[model samples]
Target: MKRKWKFFIGGLVVVAALGYLGYQGFIASAAYQYELGEYLAQPGIDASQNVQVAGQVATGSIEQKSFDLKFTMTDGVNNMVVVYQGTVPDSFRAGGEVVVAGRRDPASGVFEATQVMPKCASKYVAE
Candidate 1:
């Protein structure tokens, strides 16, 4: 009787601990996806939250202001301006597909990108 009670309590504690760890893992890693239109519509997005926005850079819209790079990204009708301070990838050219991860300053309406990755097309090769 006593042994059974002890085992049941121990199992319950282990399950609770595992559940807490899983919740912690989810909270520690925060990621959000935004389409260009949805992102533009939300003009008040918190700048401190890490986010990923998918879009294409508008052609002839890239401008560099000192260390900060600015450009207009578009998804058909909607357009949003983005800014980043770091070095850009060699393949990051105008009208190219890219996934940008960073924070958006609501005050300035500029996206400060911490990381930018280009999406390249996969070519098939005959073996």
Candidate 2:
């Protein structure tokens, strides 16, 4: 009976540890999506937390230096500069819509993008 009780307690401890890890993972991976205007309206956005912002690429704002890219995204009312170091998507271009995931710098206000997802123009058009 003592051996059974020890085994049960060990199993419970393992389950509790797994649950705690899962919760932490979920919290770390979860990111909130925002439009450009909505993101700009937030006065106290946490710079350490990852966030996603969607907007149209500003015309004449794309500049690339090898794998590094710099561009401006706008929501007609506000604009934000985005800097990313990665392969540019084939569909990305000026005037196209994009969603960028990363943290915004508190000092410079530039968005340091970890990922860029270009929205296909054709797929979003009304038939």
Give per-residue CA lDDT, model 2, range 1-127, as digits (tens): 9999999999999999999999999998888999999999996888988899999999999999999999999998899999999999999999999999999998999999999999987656568
Write down the TM-score of every candidate.
Answer: 0.68, 0.92
With a 3 Å backbone cut-off (N, CA, C), the pairs that clash in candidate 2 are none
Worst 10 residues of 1 by lDDT: 116-125
Model 1 segments more than 4 A misplaced: 1-29, 65-67, 122-127
Provide backbone clash counts, one per model. 0, 0
In angstroms, how far off is 90's CA in candidate 1? 1.3
Q: What is candidate 1's TM-score against the reference?
A: 0.68
Error of 2 at 118 (Å): 0.6
